[model samples]
Target: MESILATMGDQLGQMLVVLGGALAVGFAGSGSAWGIGLANEAAAGIMTEDPKKFGYALVLLALPGTQGIYGLLVAVLAMQKAGLLGGGSVALTVWQGFGICCACLPIAIAGFYSAIWQGKSSAATILMIAKRPEQIGKAVILPAMCETYAVFGLLVSILMLNGIKL
Candidate 1:
């Protein structure tokens, strides 16, 4: 009976760790899709007006996609940390699994929100550059401001994941 209960507990912990990886990928991927869509809509409009601005609009449109990549990085790191990536296993208590899940949340939440707001900022910058194409340099900076938070989130997630010993 004791061995059976311990097995069940270990299974639950493994499941929770998998869930964390899924959440990181799912939420961040969805946000990237939405954010990219938002920016593309604006880019399409600007391009329609002035086809020549495609080069400028493309740069701004790509900014929001970074959050998804950051999320993926965290997911991969977490999986590697948990020994799930290399077809190995780690004995994690439920508390340890929960801690890993919580660690992933910073990047998951930040990536989602930051990508969205960055898209909005990118859209605005797209419109701005439509008129003053010469201001492309300055325009890129606006959307980049929103990216800062995503970077911070990624950093925190990495640090947290590293702190959790298997």
Candidate 2:
């Protein structure tokens, strides 16, 4: 009975860790998709007005995509940390698994929100550049501002993952 219970506990821990990885990837990836879609809609409109603006519009459309990349990085790191990426698996305690899950939340939440807002910002910038193409430089900076939070979240998640002992 004792051994069976211990095994169950270990399995539960592993499940939690996997859940953490899923949350990191799922939330961030979905957010990026939505963000890209939002920006694409705006870019399509702008491009219709002047097909020459494609180059400038492409840059803005790609800005929100970085958050998804950041989320994937975090998820990969978490999986590697948990030994799930490799053939072997770590025997994590329930507390350790929960901690890992919590650690992933920073990037998961920040990436989701920042990407959506950044997309909105990018859409507005796309419209602005439609009129004054020369201002593309300054316009890029506006959407880039929203990226700062996503970067911070990624940083915190990395740091937290590093701090967690296997």
Candidate 3:
């Protein structure tokens, strides 16, 4: 039984590697997409009021998108260590492979949810700003509050990878 488990782990390691990478990419990208969506929606709304702010709004929307990039970076770093891009050549243990997969989950899950929540939050703030421009700073700060953990998650994944044998 132990031998079978080990064999399965070895075989599953590759799958986990790919899965982790995909999850990282998917999770972070989803957040970015939603953030971009919020920005676009806001831009459309703002453009109706003043077209000059379009560029500024675009930057604001894209700011939340940095989370996804961080997730992707962690995934890529893990994959690189896994030799997906020809870096990791060592044989990975079941524990190591499992750790690699687990490491990615934090940012993926956090980024995915936070971005969406932030988007809605952004929309509300933007709307509030529409009524009173003085609320813009508060609006911006609100979404940022959600983004810290996603960044931390990304950091965790990177550190987790750093400790992995891969």
Candidate 4:
């Protein structure tokens, strides 16, 4: 009975680690998709009005995609830390697994919201570019500003993961 309980506990811990990775990827990717979709719709509308501005529209639409990539990185790192990627799987205590999950939380939550807000900013930038094609540089800067918070989230996630004891 003791062995069985220990085994079950370990399994739950492993599941929590896996859940962290899934949440990191799923939430962040979903946000990026939402943001990109919004920007793309706006881009398409702009293109219909002025096909010549496709290049500008494309640039703006792509800005929010970085968050998805950041989320993916966090997920991969979490998996590696959880021993899901390397050949030797590590046996993690429940506390360790919970720590891993908490580490992933920053990126998962922040990336989701940042991507969405960035997309909105990018979509607005697209409209601005449509009006003043010459201000392309300035327009890009606005959306890029929204990317800062996503970077912060990525940094925090990395730091938290690094601080976690195996």
Candidate 5:
């Protein structure tokens, strides 16, 4: 039984690493898409009332997209660390695979939820913009503040991926 468990871990290591990368990309992108969709919906309502605000409203709608991009970046970095890129494969121990997966979690979790909340903030900013067009500068800042954590997550994931030795 012990031998079987060891073999299972060995066999599953590479797959787990790949799965981690996939999860990072998938969750973050999905969250961004949902958040952007929500913000866009609100923007559409505002657009109907005042078409002149399209450009301003779009700025807020686009804010959540950064998290998805960050996710993709982290996925790429994770894949590279896993040696799944550049047509070169490296054999990873089960523990290494587990490390990679663990490293991905910070960005995956942070990016997913941060984007949703950022979208909410953006939507609220959009509302503020609708009410006070002159306050557009202040409106953009509100959503941007939520982005700080996603950036930190991306940084940590990068550092963790870089630190892992195949």
Candidate 6:
């Protein structure tokens, strides 16, 4: 029993290592899932309203999911930092681990809101497309505008993760 207790104490110190990596993988992926769901829902609604608008809605809904991919990149980096890749000491401090988490936060936060906005706008745009498919260009412009923020979030995450010591 004492040996087991000693092992548990040792593991306690390593918890941050697991936590930092988990944060990156879990939250980042969820952000993407949220975006996908909202966009999909909006696309479904638009498709029911106007079947011809399918292509445009599909692209718009997919755009938000790109942010999730950015999160996944950071997660992979975190695992590398934790030495799950080549088994070198990353020795990530609490502050460093926290910073990594912060790096992923923007994508998770910005992605959640922007996806909904894009989805709704896409739904509206689908109507315009149904009326005139040539107007699809203009309809896409709104979601394109929303994409700027997701891009910024991805950029920030990439920059921060680059600095993490592995």
For model 2, state the Cα shift of residue 26 in Å: 1.2
lDDT for each candidate structure: 0.88, 0.90, 0.77, 0.89, 0.88, 0.64
Q: Which residue window of length 10 is worst by lDDT in model 4? A: 10-19
**Per-residue C-alpha lDDT of model 2 across residues 28-98, encoded as one tens digit per residue:** 87788888899999999998889999999999999999999999999888888888886598888899988
lDDT of 1 by residue, 28-134 (tens): 77777778899999999999999999999999989999999988998888878788887778888898888888888888999999999999999999999988999
lDDT at residue 152 of model 6 (Cα atoms): 79
Clashing pairs in 1: none
**Where's the lowest-lDDT run of ten residues in candidate 5?**
7-16
lDDT of 4 by residue, 117-137 (tens): 989999998999889999999
Which portions of model 2 miss their true places by more than 4 Å?
1-6
Q: State TM-scores per candidate.
A: 0.93, 0.94, 0.82, 0.94, 0.91, 0.73
Candidate 5 per-residue C-alpha lDDT over 1-166 given as tens digits, one digit per residue, 9 for 90 to 100:
9999887877787888888888888888887997898888889988999999999999999999999999898888877877788857778887888889888877888899989999999998898889899999999999899899989989999899888887
Predicted structure 3, TM vs. truth: 0.82
**Candidate 3 residue-wise lDDT, 1-166, digit = tens:** 9999878777777668778888998988888798769767976898799776665565457666877887788788877877778755657665677788888888898888877777766666666666666666786787788788787888888888888765
User: Which scores greater on lDDT, model 3 or model 6?
Assistant: 3
Which residue pairs show collisions in model 3?
none
Clashes of each: 0, 0, 0, 0, 0, 0
Ranked by lDDT, the better of candidates 1 and 2 is 2
Error of 3 at 38 (Å): 2.8
